[model samples]
Target: MIGALLIILFSTKDVWAPDNINGLILLYNGDIETGSIVRVEEYNLLAYAIQTTLTQTVLEI
Candidate 1:
């Protein structure tokens, strides 16, 4: 059950250059990732994060 959730989570689409507000994402594994959440669509949520090291991470909400 957990594995399936992970697969679904990682499989969701990523948002880029979003025009929205910042929010926090609480994962099922007790990990938290923050980013600007554009919005939630159909079965997926979209967000993007830029790190201090000049790296970017895009994830589903």
Candidate 2:
């Protein structure tokens, strides 16, 4: 999960430079089925929260 997220993030930032992290996430979630769905959703929400918090923190700094 974290690996996928890192891939996605790096891909977004043009850092690690994957062609399609979104596709990878879809394949991963599909392969794992219900558990993956739940976990991905939860992780996404957590990631969003963390990102928001970090952004806010950086702004305050």
> What C-alpha lDDT values do all the predictions have?
0.43, 0.39
Give per-residue CA lDDT, model 2, range 1-61, as digits (tens).
9999977887777633343565466455653232222224543542111111211211110
TM-score: model 2 vs. ground truth? 0.23
TM-score per prediction, in order, is 0.25, 0.23
User: For candidate 1, lDDT tens digit of each residue in 8-52?
Assistant: 766753542121112222233324345544555775665554321
Candidate 1's C-alpha lDDT?
Answer: 0.43
Regions of candidate 1 where Cα sits further than 4 Å from its true position: 13-21, 24-61
lDDT of 1 at 61: 38
How many residue pairs clash per model? 0, 0
